[model samples]
Structures are given as structure tokens and as C-alpha cells.
Target: MIPHQWYIVLESREIKPGQIVGVTRFGERLVFWRTTEGELVCLRDKCIHRGASLAIGKHHGDEIACPFHGFRYDKTGKVTLIPANGKSSEVASYFHIKRYPVREKLGWVFVWWGESEPTHEPVYFDNVDESFSWSSSRHLWPVHYSRAIENQLDLVHLPFVHTNTIGRGKKTLVNGPVQVVRDGNIAFWVYNEVDHGQKPKKAEDLPPPDFSRQHIHFIFPNMWQNYILDKMRVLVAFVPVDESHTLIYLRVAQKFVRLPLLRKLVDFLALRFSQVVLHQDERVVITQIPIATQLHMEEKLIPGDLPIITYRQMRERLKNV
Candidate 1:
């Protein structure tokens, strides 16, 4: 995981008011809840006293009370009421657990995963407004988050992996598959054709792809967008669960159909087809030798792997920064 970036953890609708939701993310146990006013809060699940799971405890208005000892805590993870120490007794300032800074945007919950305080909110895809309706699907992959993200950046695998679906053309020849990077974000334009015993062109040798055309875009941390059309898009979030697991959240957003009923049908069908495409990639990705990938690996890379190579280099630089 990058040291100081915001990572998407869950969708906005997942947490209900007055409900304590416990889940594991970034290899740590976290407890999330909403106050009566619908404000979100996140804290480490473990309690300071007796090491109890605070998520299983009760909710007292805006505070949560540990089940084992009835030690109530506020949103900041500071002890508000210690039953063991009388109600009137003062709780020490040092008695508190870790609190994660959170931000909500575009119907997703993002959490800061570093020691330093965050200076900015999560960056989202621009031009997508409330007019777009979306449908989402989630799948868990038994590989590292980095591996899952790299699969999306791979341009050469479509012809082989998704042969009958999106890759029916058998475009074995990859030309440029041009990549553009800006501020830790990347946009990709693909130019593939059927192999005819001709030499493939280098990325720099090809002419610039049309900027007006739809392309694939990815932002730092863990979010990707397939700008299929002005009114259509496919968004994905590669959420880290552990060293060997990743939760993929896929969504199809479209604004072409405005009727409530028809929009529902369009989103549902789009998401269903999208899931099929995702599963195709999953079957091959899970078999990779290592669950994770590094900037410098033992395996050899080809010219077609420019996007993946760029991703690795960017990731390496971010980890150290």
C-alpha cells in the first residue's frame, strides 16, 4: 500500500446510521459506524482494555461501548465513559485507540492509511455528474491488490483471455497502446490489430491517439475508469484485504437512459456483462506465480507491457515518497 494516499474502503450505502460495521482492510481490523446524524467514523477494532473487539459492543448515541468492560468511546477513539472507573471519574488523555481519517466522495468511503495527517481529499474522475446512474458488483480475488490492478492495465491479454467476449477480433498485434502519465495518474489509448507477420511499432513511434476519443484512465491509490463514451463508463476499485486477497468493486455508470425503469435494466445488464469480462481476467490472474508484483521482477517483460511497467515504476516511487 502507498504510505500517504487515500484508499477506497466501502460504498456509502454499506454503513447505516447507528450500526457498527467491522471489516478488515489494508491487513488491519477496522470498525466503522455512523452517528445519528449520519457522520462516518473509523477506529481500530481492538480495545485498549482486555483487547476486546469493540465492534461487537453496543452503541450509545454517537459513542460506542466495549462489550467486555463497558468502556464507551467517542468518534476520536477517546474514552468518554469508563464504567470500571466511576461515571464522574476523569479518563486520561492518553487512553484512546487509533482513529483513521475518512472522506466520502462519489458514493464511496475513503480512509487515510498513513501516519501523517492527510492534506487533500481523494481524487475522483471529472465530468461524471449526478445525471449518471450506476450499478455495482464485488468479487474477491485470491491475489495481492497490485496484481489485480496490473491485470486491468494489461493490453495484450484481451485477445487470449477474453477471446469470445471483448476480444473476438483476435487482435494479436499491439501498436503503442499509448500511455500518458500526469500527477500520478495514467490514461491509456489502445491501437491493436490482427497480426500479419509485420513488426509492431514502438509506443513513441506511433502518432498521438485522438484525445477526444474514449480511453482508459487510472488514478493513484486504487481507482480505474473505462471511459467508453461521454455518457457511459466502467469504474473499478481494487481494495486491499490482506497480503493474499483483494476485493474488486466494479461499477457501470451510464446516463443514456433516463427513465427510471429502463435505467435500472441498462445498469443491470451492463454490470452483468462487465462481471463476465472481469471473471475471465480473474481465472488467469490468480495463477500468477507470486500473489504480488514488484517494480523489478525476475520475469522478462515485452514492449506491449509498457502500461504495467509504468505502473510498477510509479508505485515504487510513491512507496518511498
Candidate 2:
């Protein structure tokens, strides 16, 4: 994971009001809960004194009580009360666990995973708004988050991997995939065609990007958007669970249908179909060697891999910042 960036770790619906949930994210055991007033809180799951998991403890107002010895902790992970020491005793300063800064945006839970303070809010696609109705689904992949992200940027696998669906036209020749990078994000246009004994064009020779046509947008770290149409889009968040696991949160958003019930039905069916398309890519992505990707690799690259190459290059630069 890149330091100092807000990484989406879970969906807002996963944790209900007055509910405390325990989950593993970023290779650490974590506990998340809402206070009586619905304020979000996150902390390490372990107790500092006895090494017990605090997730199973009871909630006392804005604080959580350790189940083992009845030690009470606040949202800041500081121990407030030790039952054995009586009510008048003051807890030591060193008896505390780690606390993480959390925020909620567009129905997603984001956590600050770096040593320094967060500089800004998480970056999201600006075009999507509340006017669009969306349906969401989750999938767990046995590969690193980087691998899952690159799969969406890859343009050469459509004809061979998804031949029956989106690649039905069998457009084997890839033209310039014009790309633009700004504010640590990438927006690119795809121009592919069928082979008729003609050479492919380079990105430099292609015309300027046509926003009126189909294009794809990606934000640094972990968010992607497939701009299928102005009113219809596919959004994905590649959440890291550990070094070799990723949880994909996929959503289909549309504004064509206005009726509430019919809109829901349409969103559901569209999401189901999107799942089919994603599974087709999943089957091959999981089998990739080394499970993770880096800026430099041993395999050869082609012109059609311009998006993937650009992603890697930018990722390398951001890892240090």
C-alpha cells in the first residue's frame, strides 16, 4: 500500500449503527465501530495489557471494554479504566493500542495507513453524483491489489480473454491508446480495430483524445471508472487484505430509469451481468506469476500495453512520495 493515501477498506453498509465489527485489512487485525452518536472509530484489535482481542468486548458509550479483564478503552485506544485497580486509579500513559484515522465517502470507508498525518481527502471521480442509482457487489481475489488494478488497465487481453462478450468483434489490432496524467491520476482513450494486414499506430501519431467517445479513468492507489456512457458507468475499488489477497468492490451506476422499483431492478440485473464480465477476467488474473507486480519485470511488453506500462511507471514514482 502507498503511504499517506486514503485507501478504501470497507463499505459503509457493512457496519451498522451501534455495531462493532472485526476484520483483517492491510495485513493487520482491526476493529471498527460507531459511537452512540454514529461517529466512526477504528483501532487495533488487540489489548495492550493481556494481548486479548478487544473486538469481542462490550461498548460503553463512546468507548469499548476489554472482555478479558474488563479494561475500558476510548476511541483513541487509551485505556481509561482497569477493573482490578478500582475506579479511583489512573491508567498509565503507556497502556494503549494503535489508532487509525478514518473517513466515509460515497458509501465507502477509507483509512489513513501511513505514519504521517493525511494531507487531503480521498480522490473520487467527479462526474458521478447522487442523481445516479447504483448497485454493488463484492469479490475476493487471491492476488495482490496491484495485480487486480493492472487487469483493468490491460487492453490487449480483451479479444483473447473475453472473446464471447465485450470482445465479440475480434479486434486484434490496437491503435494509439492516448493517455493523460494529471494530479496523480490517469485518463486514457482506447482505439482498437480488426486486423486486415495493416500496421498498428503509435500513441504519438494518433489524434487527440475524443472525450465524446468511450474512455476510461483511473485514480492513484485504488479506484477505477469505466465510462461506458455519460449516464452509465462501472466503478471498482481494489482493497488490499494482505500481501497476496484483494477484495474488489464493484458497482454499476445508471441514471436512465427514474421509477424507484424499476431503477432498482435495472441496477441489479446490470450488476449481475457485470459480475459475469469480471469473472472472465478473474480466471486468468489469479494465475499470474508472483501474485504482485512492480515497475520492472522480466516479461516483454507491446504497444497495446501502453496503459499498463504507464500505470507501473506512475506507481513507482508515487510509492516514494
Best prediction by TM-score: 1
**Positional deviation of 309 in candidate 1, in angstroms?**
0.3
- Give the count of colliding residue pairs in each prediction: 0, 0
TM-score of each candidate? 0.98, 0.96
Q: Candidate 1 lDDT, tens digit per residue, 1-321? A: 888999998998888887898899999999999988889999999998888888899999999999999999899999988997999999999889999999898898999999999988788888666778999989999999999999999999989999998888999899997889998788898888899998898877887855567788889889999888989999999999998999999989999999999999999999999999999999999999888999988879988888899999999999998
Candidate 2 yields a Cα-based lDDT of: 0.89
lDDT of 1 at 12: 84
Native-vs-model 1 lDDT? 0.91
Model 2 — which ten-residue stretch has the worst lDDT?
207-216
* Candidate 2: residue 151 Cα off by (Å): 0.2
